[model samples]
Target: MEPDHEVLVVGAGFSGLCVGIRLRRKGVRDFVILDAAPSVGGVWRHNTYPGVAVDIPSATYCYSFEPNPGWTRSFAPGAEVRAYAEHCADKYRLRPHLRLNTRVERAVFDEDADLWRVATTGGEITARFVVSAVGPLDQPKNPDIPGIDDFAGTVLHTARWDHGHDVAGERVAVIGTGASGLQVIPELAGKAAHLDVYQRTPIWVFPKVDFAIPTPVRALFRIAPPVQRLVRLVTAAASEVIMVLGIVHYSKVPFLVRAVEALCRAHLRRQVPDRALRRALTPRYGFGCKRPSFSNRYFPTFMRDDVDLVTTPIDRVTPKGIVTADGREREIDTLVLATGFKILELGAMPPFPVVGLDGVELGAYWDEHRYQTYEGLSVPQAPNFWLMNGPYTVTGASWFSIIEAGATHAVRCIAEARRRRATRMTVKRGPHDAFTRDMRRRMRGTILAQPSCARSNSYYFDRHGDAPYVRPQSGLHVWRRARTFDLDDYSYGP
Candidate 1:
């Protein structure tokens, strides 16, 4: 069968939208965008957990195309984010070309014709190029706690909050101390009759300092995106740079992490007042070993007389509630799990299979090491396939900026390919080997490399201290490299 479109975008989020817009801007509209959800917003549509909001300022969180002058808050909420994505789709006129409710099951590359044959739940479609903008956090992962199914009352992951479930005045148990858990716990504290916060380790929390984006500020943003974007860039840079000292070189620069952690510990001590609870909630691991989170309200929630912080490991769950390995059983009517997404699960690596230069399946090779893509976009053997928000593309700043940078790179590659009438092009193994070695070399004393970090088996994983996935540098450096799109790094075939 013949191909369906020139380009097949596997998401309708900011990245996919940007890719579509860039294609249109270059006068190429023969693209089709497919999303499993019935609407445009991907993660934003699903993650409506309590107190959910972006930490980044509104300007950086938004698209470069359609800026909403009416941002009520400095850090936009879920609804506003969804609205912004929808608004951008409308502004760029990308909705007409998007197919909602279409779940991509698999996409295989046809070596002979050099096309991507994407099989969705609905049907099959093909395109010469495939853009996987499926952000890492899009897939919700359920914790594998034994006997969780036997829980008679309610169970829901934070990313897939069940609005219909009445959590008010009910006894609740929340598992996992990740970012999602930290964000949602505070919101649930007051409402639940009693709340049990199960923690393997405590997370580093700082003040959010969130504020309203007054009407005047919104007006300025809408009227001047360029100025707003500039300010956004500067602020994001400032924030990210401060954080770098604590994360990338934690051992060399222990003072900042210690200082910030001390501040958080002090915050907890002041709020909780009870030394026992404070001790239970205090983080033992090196600060910044895991992702650092911020919240004005999280510490205060623990002060509530009804909340309990259980640091003990779980043995199993009963028909009623959880049983800690310490031989204590705590019963609860509801379970709110915040165990974030499957960070390790790369959806069908190769994602689109590669019949490489040697006809070896790139999928099989990447299986040995979660997915390996050069520059987190192009694999060594995959031609004309780009992954947005792929491995290491995630940023502490704004993920949207990463998406924008990638879109820029993708368009440049597409333009060159069209110009040369190239049937296929793949990043050479030499460039990828050089880049990966450099990236891992720079990862040495970073948070992901600590001996204490090595001891822990949490999601802040480095393969029990062997393999690495997280990037070692700042997003700005990533942006600089991504913007370049070095054609020399790739080998082309006609």
Candidate 2:
């Protein structure tokens, strides 16, 4: 058997890119990075909708090692973020090791051989270690509404923004008011002659304190690590307030939660003077449910004369427009589906078929609630296979932090594999089960599972019906957990 390299990193997005970068620093250059797309930036590259920008401040949205002193906007847009990823790849000279436009079809852990046999849409590759950083938000999800395909007009998911399609002066139907819709609607509001937003459930919206990071301020931060760290700390602390009120206190909605709900209501009422329409747009859920967005401009978009909020259920799509269950017909040419991604399929398995240990399909293994892995990194039954950003790892804060954490964890696992001189390693069943169960128990106590949690379709849950992706605590906790690894927690077999 030949080694594709010491490691085969899946996905060239932030997670995989960071993993490859750190692995290179550790002097392991014999690795390859694969991505389904033709370039980097992952979600940022794909989600190029109008008004697409980071909800979080730009102060903390970067690598701990490298800081940018020239972000034009405080809340940088998609292009800047994508450019940052591209810069990282170029600065680190990571393109040569990257194989773009190649998708992994399948990967199987050969227990006896002690290696992962990897197959791709391009070709087969063997590696001593396989790192999955495919990302949690790469695959766009379409709503289960019947005839979504039957829409005679152009239907586009936010991720796959159709640059070629024109919505100008045309009537449009925007489905789903989640983060994507919030960003796109405001940009599309004035363009479309008439816009109808079919919102199933109202979402918690807060004002985005977005501003510009002046060049002097950026220069100051470039030299002073303390300033940047302080900014990150403040933002982290503010985000933590929501986590405390929502995640820890799952039972009751706190008073601040009430205040936020009221504030959002007031904003809606103030912007859209029509009492009837304002009443239709107010959210019934708590502020922190469903990853509340901060947008100072989102609500005002609804106030536009041409914009209308429709809470009615959709019967189906006709040739020219959407027919609501209430029997109203809204004619539209373009339909923008702001529905989210298939998050579970993100750390996507290979395209062919992955048979782990005893000829078991990887998908079925997870389906049986046995997607066991140590620290959500490596499976005991699966040799030389690793998952990054796999489970219980989403941070409302910068995912740059989580990606680095996962990268740190992956580097450690690779080091352990090297030290053991083993062809592959898998976490033992007992520990894997224990950790996963502990994660669930912790999450159930979070605001994410509360009764007021997002009634809308969210990709936060796994098949086992658990908040398997969100980190229930601090970003620092994740960093610390990934930085330090205990081999005893995992069983190493050759």
Candidate 3:
């Protein structure tokens, strides 16, 4: 059987769009970008809750090749970011190659033909190579609470937010106080009649340095595009200093943590005047253990008269409201689940079984053996299969840079395979194992590897308390390594 396409890219997000744009530039036309959603943007499309904006600075968040000149603020809002994703798809003329609302169910490797048999909601399609760009935090996580289904008033996850629902007069209950929760709570503070934020684990909150870009500045960016690129470079370098001092080299200089923690405390004290509320919001664990949120209004929102910070252990969810362990039931009309996503087990299976060599299901194999990828791109047995935001590939900052790095690496691999007249290309088992081992070794003594991480309810850890999701390295480190194409690392078959 002939292949449907030379390459099948599963997802149309930042990583997937990068693949599409780069493939077109590389003169590779036989490819299609498939997305389960009706639109292009992945998380940006789904998350449209009020006050939704990026945590990272907008300058460094964009592509190096396609620097956006029209960003209104230093930290762009979610709507603008989503529009940027659409702009990329349009600018690259990728719409012709996009298959929207088509979810890929399963993809199995055909050993004999050195091809992939991909099954989707539409039908079966085949490709010579399969690239999985399904993001790490795409799947929304619903809390394991009894009677969650019974909550009849209104139920919504932050990712699947219902904007039409009238939150103006409703008593809203927001579960979890992570990044999403912090952003959403501030927006709901004024609108909701009463906002009860359930905090199981307190997270460190710092001030957000967000400001609108003046018209003259934007005009200058439009005229001199290199000016914007220079700004991006400067922003990235500043973030790297924080990554090295506060995160990567934490064990060597422990005082760095104390200094950063003091700054966070000062920020909190300046915002919240009440001692009890300040104590409730304060995080006990060391900084960088879990993801710290950046917001100017998150702390001040708690001071509002209508808002109630609930620290009680939730026993279960009732139809009316939440029942606490102390038997106090706080009745609420709406439930907003800011609980986050399944990160560690990200994209393990996409609705159906991904059978690789010897009929090993990808999900079950990962559950037992954990992720085994060569530089978080190619696996040992999965030939011509590459994952975009795969295991241990996520850096400390500059997400777009990381995406670009992975996309370029995948594109290079495909080009090399074609040059060698190879039908199958897979990472050698030795190199794959060595990389995974090295990542584990490097994780030792880092902030995430410390015992304090257990105190924080972060999605970084697997079942055994090991962080299989984080790269534990700087963005520059991964970016440089990805650009360095080492052909000896892979094994090719004709």
Candidate with best lDDT: 3
Cα lDDT tens digits for candidate 2, 344-413? 5423422234677888776566656534456766665566677787766776557688778888887887
Candidate 3 displacement at residue 78 in angstroms: 0.7
Give the per-residue lDDT digits (tens) of candidate 3, residues 1-494. Answer: 56999999999989899999989988899999999999989989999988899988999989999999999998999999999999999999999999999998889999988999999999988999988988876888999988889987899899999878989999999998999998999999989999999999988877789999999999999999999999999988877766666776788877887788898899999999999999999997888888887888999999999999999899999889999899999899999999998777635433246778988777677767776578878787688888888778877658898899999999989988888988899898888899989888888867887788888878877766677677878888888888895877999887
Determine which window of 10 residues in candidate 3 has minimal summed lDDT.
344-353
Candidate 1 clash figure, as a count: 0
- lDDT score for residue 201 of model 1: 78
Error of 3 at 189 (Å): 1.0
If scored against the real structure, what TM-score would every candidate get? 0.93, 0.93, 0.98
Tens digit per residue, CA lDDT, model 1, 159-248:
899888979999999998777888889888989999999988777676676898777777777787777878777877866765567777
Distance from true location, Cα of 353 in model 2, Å: 5.4
At residue 469, candidate 3 shows an lDDT of 73
Clashes of each: 0, 13, 0
The runs of at least 3 residues in candidate 2 whose Cα sits more than 4 Å from the true structure, single-residue gaps closed, are: 249-256, 259-263, 345-353, 370-373
